[model samples]
Target: MPPAYVEALGSVAAVLTTFCWIPQAVKVIRTRETRAISLTTQVALSVGVVLWLLYGILHVSWPLIGANAVTLVLLIVILAMKLRHG
Candidate 1:
């Protein structure tokens, strides 16, 4: 595959995964209810995202790095809300 095509694929993947948390994050922000959220899930996801970010950095892939960075922040917010409202 061409390099540009590969990069485009990665960017699409990054965009999807990064924005997947938005709905739940918005709900939490509005409702402030996170009792149903799982700490294990959140922690696992955060760790996974961090790992992806690190991998992106190592690979020098800006799309992956940027997507994961934003996702990490959003994940942190959800985790905090879960802790507060659990």
Candidate 2:
């Protein structure tokens, strides 16, 4: 395992990157304007996030697992919105 400080750093980085999707999610939810969103990109990104989550699980990396898990949820929400609104 890495040092505690290293893990903490990873956690901080994970939180920042993971929550960065919030603004976009909020905008999509509030506006319900998903016509500009691309289904293909969302699908691809969701798949990639899933894969990253899987990789994190396999490696027993908490930061990677947590971040990717949250990201996957956000991606799903956006993708669902895109499908519903577009």
Candidate 3:
């Protein structure tokens, strides 16, 4: 396993990148405006995140697993909104 500080740093970075989707999600939720969002992009991103999550699970990497899990959920929410709104 990596050092404690290394894992901490990984977790910190993961948190930042993972939660960065919050603003987009909140905007979509509030405005119900997803016309500008690209279905292809969201689909690709969700698939990538799911793959990353699977990789992390197989490797037992907490940072990757946690980040990708949350990212996948956010992407799903956005994708669902896009489908519903558009």
Candidate 3, residues 1-86, lDDT tens digits: the string is 66998978877887888999999999999999999899999999999999999999999988789889999988898999999999
lDDT of 1 by residue, 34-58 (tens): 8888899999999999999999999
**Model 3 residue pairs with clashes:** none
Q: State how far residue 78 of model 2 sits from its true place (Å).
A: 0.5
TM-score ranking, best first:
3, 2, 1
Model 3 misplaced stretches (Cα beyond 4 Å): 1-11
CA lDDT, every prediction? Answer: 0.91, 0.90, 0.92
Question: C-alpha displacement of 48 in model 3, angstroms?
Answer: 0.2
- lDDT score, residue 37, model 2? 83
**Distance from true position, residue 23, model 2, in Å?**
1.0
CA lDDT for candidate 1: 0.91
* Best TM-score among the predictions, by candidate number: 3
